[model samples]
Target chain A: MSAALAVEGLTVGYAGAPVLDGLALAVAPGEVVALLGANGAGKTTLLRALSGLTAPRAGRVLLDGADLSDLSVEDRARRGLAQVPEGRSVVTELTVDENLHLGALWCHPGRAARRVAVARTYDLFEPLARRRSSLGHQLSGGERQMLALGRALLARPRVLLLDEPSLGLAPRVVSQLMGVLRATARETGLTVLLAEQNVTSALSIADRGVVLSLGAVVVDAPAAELADDPALRHAYLGF
Target chain B: MDRLVFLLATGLARGLVVALFALSLVIVWRAARLVNFAQAAVATVAVFAAFAVTGATGSFWAGLAAALLTGAAVNAAVERGLVRRVPQGSPLPGMIVAIGLVMVLQSALGIAFGPRHRPMAAPFDERPFVVGGVPLLSPYDLFVLTVALALVGLLAWLFNGTTLGLQLRASAAAPEVSRLLGVRVPRMVTLGWALSGAVAALAALLLVPTELGLNAHSADLLFVHAFTVAVLGGLDSPTGALIGGVLVGVLVSLVTGYLGAGVAPLAVLALLTLVLLVRPAGIFAAAQVRAA
Candidate 1:
């Protein structure tokens, strides 16, 4: 079967210096891939480029064997590519319910369908349900992450890209988040490319681990092998 | 007491128009993050289109419909063709482009239509209704009031009750996140401009019949007062636009009624300055500033 998301010769940069230089990777459908690296490892850039937020210098991104070169960010999203961006992704001015409704906007056209999707999300994220009327800024860090994840999930995307979800969250919160992601992936067969600095938590849920060093993938191995190899973890992930 | 009542009544009618125009500014600001300096010029063009339609068909309703559609179409075109090309990292480039557009549109209008004011007739009677020997709202003023209230109500329902409104709000607040979730952010911005243009056109249409007439600069004073109202109510809040428009309207009416017409502009300036001093964000501004 074709890879769900394929990146070839992907080079991206800022002000002339390439952040991601000639990177190539492929993620199979329904596979949970942990993109592990330290800060400035081009993980964020890769996700952004794949989602069409950042333009690639000399490369192509393919979604299910379809080239996404000319597609706009929103067009990429409409084609089942969803990203939960790092740091305060929720629209802080809007209430939690409003944020979720936005997620279901294009995916679920009918009002009834949208309502059902929103209600289901609220049920899954109990904290969000309790604070339905509350604005995004009012939520705690973990709650904000939950809201962001919940909002992205409402899109019913085929491939979900997440950036630094475990950043600045408590251990239990991270575990809870990872658990929800794992459960959702298992139930729905959702494909995920999760970028993370929290190696242990990411590996716990990811089926495969792709370690990056200075923008190119240094190791593409099973999640179990990467978790067991302490040398690989310390060198690339800095754990 | 009778004079006060008359002034209040007159001010209420005038304020509704100002409120409507200011609400347009608020809509554009929320959607595009820039005040459209050419709004009055754009609306004037639509009113001119209404004039042509009214002249050809001899139907005021046809003219009204023409104005609304033309306003929305022209504003959307401006956003897509001109405003979208400029760098949007800061508000300055967009504001400068809008100001330039105002000059271009006004010059083109003057060249085409000449510098003469055209008399546009109102659909309803202008004679005030008397209640117990007290002069009150006229049929025309009542019409304005009803239309203003209904439009406001409709807009409120659109933004708060519909999925499209949710996308507009989300895109404005967090464009990147909205895009990630499949919301068409640029299209939403264009729609915002269209909505603002239609509202501005309606305000100009209402005011022209009561003013000197429809000229290239007909909506100039209205734009000034509406801008002030938008600022007084906080550019981000629709509720602020409504309240601020009314407040500015009444204040201008009372100042013109008691003092002189010359002093009304000064009073508006003074109110704007005072509001800026007290609350730079406007009275109805949210407590927390939106994250950039």
Candidate 2:
């Protein structure tokens, strides 16, 4: 079963300066939550903090009611916290299959099991299946993003964090990618926390929306309500 | 004709050793993106450890095992203790640290063992076998070739077929993304250092018996050739390292055979200069010119 993720008073920064100061948010099990904000709104920082990439200065990240504040990134990932960072980070030296293999490394760590997991991922994303032997650097931008998403799915995480998955993608490609994501969430009940700039498309698949301005949540409501509120949308999301 | 055969045989044998040393450098560079200037120094210390073990037990195998362990331990310690403290995204600081390590290790070895040559007996008889009226490869040369090939094959398999290898490669290329995928990137980097140290020890052990003897600066000459191979092959490409090692080996052997022993270093320098002028990135780098 997918698990809930709760963040309370999460503060994170670099070089003694706070990027995300005293922020709190909650994601229910099997929920599709969109994190929307302008540039430098600390969406990436919040995702990094949740995935244990950036250390939080003060707060607790409760995963299924367990404190994950002290865990390492790998340890946090082992307990079902997986993240796909911004910029379509494909390991250029590795092949598509190898990238998917890494996603299963912490959990499976065995040849037979990892192979099976990779096969399942290929079934989910057929384009990646065809290009299993292709190096990451050889992949097109859209393919790279698909490879990243497929790799994350192979981990079987309870909650997946995606940072700017739709950036630099064509409109048709973005819609197609989001369509697959929506179906994947519905079928597997996988919880997702997606940080995105494409507000319209992000809300299309999101059950709830949380808007951040200057590292603090200003609008937290149902996706439909947040989308319908013209005043709030204009002020925070820029329409 | 016999002299040609002998030079070719000896050159090929020496080339294997150079390839191993170059491969070691390539492994470390691939994993951490830092050239280890102190590699020879690290191997010299391991040789000293082997020397001590061989003196105590009179068993070359036991000494070899000890040296391998010492080499791996030293490199892992360097990575975790010293190298990790430096910030990432820049190789200058790490390079400086490695250069400093080289000086310190050489001085320490000189103090402990004195600045004199020490004989290191090969495990096998060093007599070349006669073939077609020509003395070609010695049993020791054959052993070196076999071991080098086997180690290279094992490493190739490790990097191509294993999960740890995948993580190591991925971690080296993109640490942040690898971390996101649950790869313990730091651990993998440390493991790469350990593997590199062990391989560097193997290179030193092979080359020392062929040298005048073991000394504080014995591996320095070999390190120069190996460094040339690393640069010639492009630091990032292992295949480049292998081919570069062979090219340097054969080049040195042919030059010494025809031109004279004194002119070999000049030949290496000339070749390096020519390659720099023509293909600065390397023979094996992608066609696009990489930025400095």
Candidate 3:
């Protein structure tokens, strides 16, 4: 099977210092890959680079065999690459309904189709339906995360890059989010690259885990294997 | 009593024009996060286009269309050619560049059209309609009111009811996030500039006939007054611009009528200061400041 998303010799830097140096990885279709790392392990940078937010110093990001180096962020998104960026990604001024509608702006051309997609998202995330008219800032952390996920899913993306979705949430909420992610990936056959700090929860849903340290991958193994290895977890994941 | 009524009526008409222009500023600010200092000069350039077209075609309507199109095209060109090139890490550089643009545009207009004020005749009759034994809005004033209100309503609909508006609002509020969601944010920003330019041109087109006619500097005062209105309304609020425009308009009219023409600017300045002191964000500012 071909890789749904692939990165080759990816090197992203700010000013002079590289954040993601000589990184290479691949995720097959319908696979969930947890990107585990410590605080400065370049997990966020890799996601940003993949999503076309951060320009890679030297590398190729292939989305379904197409080179994404020249594409702008919106163009990349239109090609079914979506990113749920770290921290409060929602437009705080917009309502939950508007935010979801925005997600379907390019993909769903017909107004009726857009409305149906939004309604479907609301059904999938019941909390969002209850607060359809509420502003983005009005939602709780868990609700905000759900809204972010719902918004991204509305894009019907081929590959989803999520940055720290479980941040600032309770453990139960994190698990619930993980379960939804796992179910969604399985049901939709959606490829995912999840950048996370929460090791145990992330490993729970991930088919494989790729650990990074100082801009390079340190461990690339099965999720269960990484989860069970205490020394590996302590050495890299900081759990 | 009759004088007060006339002043109030005239003030309302002028206020609507100011509101329309201020709303233009609000639009550009929301979309690009930059206060376009050259808006007045850009509008003046459109007015010049309208002037030339009206003079050539002998039709005010043709001129009106010319103004709207020229304004939109020029503003879009400026955004694409100049404003987009500047460092966007802060608002100050864009503003300074805009200020420079203002100087260049005004100087260019002065050279092209000369310093003389060329009279652009109003499409409608200037004679006021008498109602209840009192003189009220002239046909021209009524015309201004109709156009301004119609444009405002159209813009309000565009921003609140349409898909493009949603994308624009999303682009304005969170540009990076909007981009990731598949919104062509740069295009939205350019569209914003185009829309603002058209509106500003229309406002200037309406106001010039009532003032000392068209000149290179015709929109300078209008820009000042409209800027005050935008700040008074809160840079981000369209409703604020509408209300603030009328309030400032009435205050200016009353001050000019009772005090002197010179005192009008001072009154606007004072009103702006008071609004700033009382509510730094403007009267209708959003409850939460968007994270930059």
Candidate 4:
């Protein structure tokens, strides 16, 4: 199958200094690729660049061989690229249902379609469904992550970029989230590029691993090999 | 007893006009998170436009429509061309720019209209309707009250019941997240400004005829009350604007009736300070948990 997402010679930075440079990576359709990196390793920057949140200083991003270098973040989202940023970024003042409603706005779904999508999301994340009327601030961290994921799902994106989905969740919650990710990939053939600091758990479900060090790919290999490599783990991941 | 009832009723009607002005401030705040100091200037310009139109066409309704359109256009222009350029976050620059706009707009109106109180006729009779020898409400007062209520209701419906409104609320709350969700945040901000302008125009149109006349400074007094009302209600909450506006209206009316017109401003300032001290977020601010 053709690569769903491709990046070449990507350079990104803030205030005239490059954070990510000459970054190249590709993911096949239906693949769950864990983007492993330590702090300041350009993981978040890479995802932000791909999702059009951050403009690349130089390089091209291709989704299904279509160049998306010139699109706005919202335009990219409409074109089936969605990102769940760190901190769960829920509109804290809005009700859980309202936040979900915002997700369908990209598609401009009909009332019936919106209702169906929301109901399906509720089914996937029962806790969110239970607190449908609760304001965004009222939800637990796990529920917020679920709500964010569900929101991304409602957009029916082809590729989902998740930035540190396991940041603050409990171990059990992270495992549950990984299971959901696997199930979603299996059912929908959704391509996922997850950036995470939780190395062990991230490698458990990721199909392949792409590790970044100092903004360039250090190791791009199958998940098992990357996890088994003691030297690479010690050098980059520090355990 | 009859005089007291009459004063209270008139005060309530006056308050509705202030409520509309407060609502305008609330709309802009919700959308762009700015106080929009130029709101009175925009309203004054709209009133002058209405006056010019009414003078030429001899149609008050047509003039009112012109005012509404002018308000929307001016507000949209300000948001698109000026306010949006001030950069997001930290409302101080936007406020400073708006204050500058207020000065520019008011001065322009003063130069164009000669800074005199020019009278515009109200569509309905100004004489109060009487019941059992009690003056309850004038036809003009009722008209103002009705128009304000209808406008507020429409705004409530627009905000709570429509997809566009949902997008607006989301856009304001988390613009980046909303952008990620595919919302056109800039467009929503413009829409918010337009809505605020229209409401401000309506409040100005209704109140100017009752004032000394249609002049550049006609909206100044109304704005002070409206600003107080907007603060008394949390800047972000619409429901707060409504209740706070009416409360201010009643307080002002009672103070004017019993303590003389001179004491009304002091009474309002005192009430505002007390509300600020007691609940810094305002009575209807949902951001905080409601006290029992």
lDDT of 1 by residue, B1-292 (tens): 8878988998999999999999999999999989999999999999999999999999999999999998899999999999999997889999999999999999999999999999989899988999999998999999999999999999999998988888888878878888888888999999999999999999989889988888899999999999999989999999999998998889998999999899999999888889889988888988875553
Deviation from native of the Cα of residue A32 in model 1, angstroms: 1.0
Which CAPRI tier for candidate 3?
high
lDDT per residue as tens, model 3, B90-152? 898899999999999999988988999888789999999999989999999999999999999
Model 1 spans > 4 angstroms off = A14-16, B289-292
How does model 4 fare in lDDT?
0.89
Task: Give iRMSD, candidate 2.
Answer: 3.8
Writing each residue's lDDT as its tens digit, candidate 4 over B1-292 gives: 9989988898899999999999999999988888999999999899888988998999999899999999999999999999989867678999999999999998888888786788888999888999999988999999999999999889989888889989988887888889888998889999999989999999999988777898888998899999989988888888888888888888888899999999999998888788889987777777643110
Error of 3 at A72 (Å): 0.6
Where's the lowest-lDDT run of ten residues in candidate 1 chain B? Answer: B283-292
lDDT at residue A2 of model 1 (Cα atoms): 98
lDDT of 2 by residue, A86-146 (tens): 8857887778988889888878767898888889888877888889999888888888999
> Candidate 2, residues B1-292: lDDT per residue as tens digits?
8888888888888888888888889889977889999999999898888888998999988888988898899999999988999887689999999999999999999998899999989888788999877998999999999988999999999998877788888887788788877778889999999999999898898889988899999889778888888889888888998888888988888899989988888888888888788887778865531111
TM-scores for all candidates: the values are: 0.98, 0.95, 0.98, 0.96
TM-score of 3: 0.98
Instruction: Identify the superior model by DockQ, candidate 1 or candidate 4.
Output: 1
lDDT of 4 at A111: 86
The better candidate by lDDT, 1 or 4, is 1
Give the least accurate 10-residue stretch of model 3 chain A, judged by summed lDDT: A12-21
Report DockQ per prediction, comma-separated.
0.76, 0.59, 0.81, 0.54
Stretches of candidate 2 off by over 4 Å are A1-3, A14-17, B287-292
Give the number of the best model, judged by DockQ: 3
